[model samples]
Target chain A: MIAKELKRGIITENSIFVLALGLCPTLAVSTSVKNGLGMGLATTFVLICSNIIISIVKNWIPGKVRIPCYIVIIATFVSILHLLIKVYTPTLDSQLGIFIPLIAVNCIILGRAEAFAAKNNPATSLVDGAVMGLGFTAALLILSTIREFLGGNKIFDLMVIPGFQPMAVFILAPGGFFVIACVMGLINYFRGKKGAKAKV
Target chain B: MTDTIKLILALTLISLIAGFAIGKANYRTKDRIAAKQQAARQGAIDAVFPEGFKIKEMNDDGGILPQKYWIAFSDDKLSGYAFEMAGSGYAGDIRFMVGVGLDGKILGLTVLEHHETPGLGSRVNEVASTKYIWFPFGGDDKTKPWFTEQFEGISTLRPIGVEKSAGEWHRLSEQARAGLRDRNAVSAITGSTITTAAFTRAIERSVSKYLEELGGYCCPATRKKREAEAGAAAGENGEETEGGDDS
Candidate 1:
């Protein structure tokens, strides 16, 4: 059961590629693999913690106030994560500056809380959060790898191909959109092909 | 009405729990964050000045910004000054530390903080490394950012120019660097002229004024001239005004 959920989270219900949640941060911090990873982990941390907390308190939380309650929980996690990052990894803290605080508003955490965590048990909610978080991180790594290599002519701040001229536009806002579109299209095409073969 | 009250209570309880958690986290990490910031500031100050130079905080009574400049001493004698200046960048403010020698030439510069565009403008703080991931240990380690390294030896007495024609400092040849030095210019980061210009403009606008103010405090000629002027003013007023020039 856990393995099936993991597969679903990572592929079918992937946050960035399939569900298309939390694209704001995806576009903003996906400039480098390091940054993308940092952001993904941070978001993942928030998602897991918030999911568990919301699920545990779901019985007590009134339906009318559930959204606000979830936000409060997610925001608390984000704030604590922000402080921890500032103290432990100041470099990543600076690189991912405003986006850290903005993670409080990321739909992935709240979406999980409302969709799965609110109705599910704490144990399953924890698993769901972890899987979804991994999905988000995987998508970010894919997008950032393409952007970082094509835009900067380097990977993880190291030179890959000597004397290779990089396309500067790939590092800009438009490049983010182009990469996301192409990746989404490719994923959809493959998924469509697989569905056709299964039917056959 | 009871249902409404229960809803309010649920949200209130959750918020209270959140508040408590965040408060605890802040209380725990506050000191570490402060220490990290202090260490970074101290590191920047050290990077801009020569090794083993003692730093003394100067009085900024008549300066534009208080606690912005510090006096660096070598062998108990005044060697130069280290300054912290902030300028408006493309996205937000860019704060940096710069060390200038007695001869008015920049010893070094290090960007302390900035909020420019990540890939473009943020290159101000980027340290260009030759370390290839494949080879890993093959290339030389470069600690200081190549962008700020070019500012070394540029005089602060004149307007600092930003030139894009020469390309980035890291890619430039020796001859091109010499040409830039001759022109009292630094190569601008590609596609980040605003950030580069803002930095140079801040230095040009404030460093000269700061030096002039420092001259009044240290330079014998300027001290004598200021004293004479003060004495003349005192005579006109028929009163003694000493140590009153600094406000």
Candidate 2:
């Protein structure tokens, strides 16, 4: 059951690439691989922590005010994460800047809390959160790799090609959209080809 | 209803716990955070005045930005002045420290914080492998460290200009270097014109306030002449007239 959830979240239903949730931070911080990884892990931690807490208290939460309760729970984890990052990792703290606080509103955590955690047991909800968080992190990694390699002519600040002229646009806002579009397009194109072969 | 009451109670309880947790975290990190901030400030000061100097905070002087001003002494003699200044940059506010020799020439400058675009204006504080500011046409050699180093030895007599008219990153000629020393021209960063201009304006404004505060100081002939030039410039600028009026 846990394995199925992991596969489902990571591949069958990716939050960013497939379901297309939480695209704002996806575009904003994917300018570099380091930022993408930082944001991805931060969001992941919030997701896992919120899901566990929400599942434990799911029975106690009133149905009419469940949404508010979930938000409060998610926000608590986000605030904790924010303070931890600010104190222990100030470099990543300043780099992510506004996005750190904005994690409270990231749809992935709330989406899972309402969709899966509300009805699942604590153990199941924990697995679901971990898998979903990994999915988000993987998607961000792919997008950031493409953007950073082309835009910065480096991967994790290491220059790949000595004299490659980096396309500056790839690291900016518009470039994020372009990279996301192309990656999703390529995925769909292969999927369509696979579907055609099945028909044959 | 009883259900509504329970809901409110639950929400309040969660809020209380969250607040307490955050408060605890804040308490634990407060001292470390302050120490880190002080270390960063010390690093900026060290970078600006690589030549040894002792700096002390001056309480009575209020500059244009209401920031703390520090007096630097080298070898038991007044060496320069260091103060904080902030201005609107291309993306957001740019805060930096300026180190000026007693003769009004810039000893060094260090950017404290800025939110400019990366790979462009954000390169203001980028450190280079070496200290020398290379001449133009140095390929990608003219980087962040080079830009700030250009201000060194340039006095604050005149407003600096971006290299817009020249359209070339040529080396400063002997005459041009003299102009730089005389505070006539300080070349701006080639690609980051707006950020460069903002920085220049911040320096000019802060230097003006610094000169005003130093007006009563008994200094040498050169310091007196520089003071007169700064005083005249200060008189014309009415926007920041508070410094002069109060004194």
Best by lDDT: 1
What would the TM-scores of all predictions be?
0.90, 0.79
DockQ of each: 0.67, 0.29
Q: Estimate, for each residue in A68-183, the C-alpha lDDT of model 1 and write its tens digit.
A: 88888899999999999998898887787778999999998999999999999999999999999999999999998899889887788888889888886777878999999999
Worst 10 residues of 1 chain B by lDDT: B238-247
Q: Judged by DockQ, which candidate is best?
A: 1
Q: In model 2, which residue pairs have backbone atoms overlapping below 3 Å?
A: none
Taking the tens digit of each residue's C-alpha lDDT, what string does model 1 give over B2-98? Answer: 9989988888878888899899999988998889988998888888998989987654333233344577889988889888877788877788888
Error of 1 at A21 (Å): 1.3
lDDT of 2 by residue, B165-195 (tens): 5422233566765655454556654456788
Model 1 residue B171 lDDT score: 83
